[model samples]
Target: MINFVKIILIFSLMASPCNSLELYGKFAQGGLITGKVDKKIDLYVDNKKIKISDKGYFVFGIPRDQTNEIVIVTKKNKKEIKKLIKKIQIRKFKIQRIDGLPKRKVSPTAEDMKKIRSEGKLISKAKNINSNLNYFFDSFIRPAKGITTGVYGSQRILNGKPRRPHYGIDIAAPKGTSVLSSNSGRVILSERNLFFTGGTVIIDHGHGLISIYSHLEKTFVKKNQLVKKGEIIATVGSTGRSTGPHLDFRLYCNNVPVDPDLVISLN
Candidate 1:
């Protein structure tokens, strides 16, 4: 009778749904996480369907100021699995005061607002381009070799006025200093004379991963161009809303802006 009961329990367990998901990488704020699941179906992060690689791999990131838990749901043929990721560490950032910004930059005129809006549309459009490339899995290199001027998540106070938290890394270099691509990607945005970021370039590194190079002195690539890792894509510049010539590098995955210093090796 005991053997019969054990056999019935084993069969019941085998009939139940199972999940064999493995997630690796940082799970804290401003961290990127890559994971693989048992089967390829549909995956949603925070209720939004994000891009998944061709090999059942998906990537996502926690924003700089996010404090809530992340929920990932995978569904296949009416069967669903919900993963509740709750161990996100909070980050404390410092406030930075800038007193030397040009008055025009700090306080943009009405015409500047129009141009800013137009350029912002272009940037947003580029970020929405999802491709099948998996180049983000490749280790990234520093976009420019320079002294680290600023970091991500730092609160920005321009001319004593509070602004958005800094979402990228700032590396100071002389004008015309070559800027390199950290990973292989297709150039999605190559704009010059933008109101704020000056000559900005954004590359799509496949699967909703994007890299941005802002305030460039010169852009060596054009829109929709393919670039390899460590290739020269731009030059350091102080154009747009900058005090000196510097490269503002940013990394994003699935619409979440993450800290490049944490993901990519700078040293």
Candidate 2:
């Protein structure tokens, strides 16, 4: 008989010849799910191969608006085996409206568009990193101390024009406020200035999981640098399409944006 495991918060699936597989974390929209399996077993989420570390740990993210049940399949000896179906809870998002001054930031000219496109490539490259480090298993801390002004999955209306849903949490703080690393990871990309994010820093926490810090006033870390959790990596600032000083904190699992709040709860 095949076993299918349904998860709510925490559970352990026993599929023998392999011992026990433990899973935990939020299982809702914009949630990040992580688990551990035996080294000999192969696992997948939604048919996409999950990169398991040598110690048998793996991670994946739930889409912000995903309503369909997640499918988890495991195979061994090049043959089909057990499966686990995870159902994610739905969430209601908030609407945010902002009235700003500069028309160019909202609607850029052809010249600015060229720069935006190029900077986008850099950001995308950093977000897609899949390293083998297992730093993601560490406890996470808030990137900075501030009041949350914007939340994940929120609809943003800028100057009465609708834009893409906000994927990061906007924390409002005074300029030069210190921003710390949420967890131990290697810096993958550190750009002083980008078209939208201004000064940005992206850290890879291993196994396709990464965290992004944007709108920085100054960066203390450089590319390929290893940072410890709660270490000061940068200072907050209002740069690149901003009205005031703030930090836009974000996290991505396999390039899919997940809620930073949900991830921090893993601590």
Q: Indicate the TM-score of model 2.
A: 0.93
Compared with the true structure, what per-residue lDDT tens digits does model 1 show for residues 74-101?
A: 6766566555555666878878787788
> Given candidate 2, what's the lDDT at residue 70?
92
After TM-score superposition, the amount by which residue 45's alpha carbon in candidate 2 deviates from its true location, in angstroms, is 0.9
User: Compared with the true structure, what per-residue lDDT tens digits does model 2 show for residues 1-267?
Assistant: 111233433334453536456676777889888888787778878898888899988889998999999988777675656677878778899999989837898999999999999988888888788889998867678999999999999999999999999999999999999999999999999988887889999999998889999999999999999999999999999988899999999999989999988877666
User: Which number leads on lDDT?
Assistant: 2
Q: What lDDT does candidate 2 reach at residue 143?
A: 92
Best by TM-score: 2
Cα miss at 184, model 1 (Å)? 0.4
Worst ten-residue run, lDDT, model 2?
Answer: 1-10
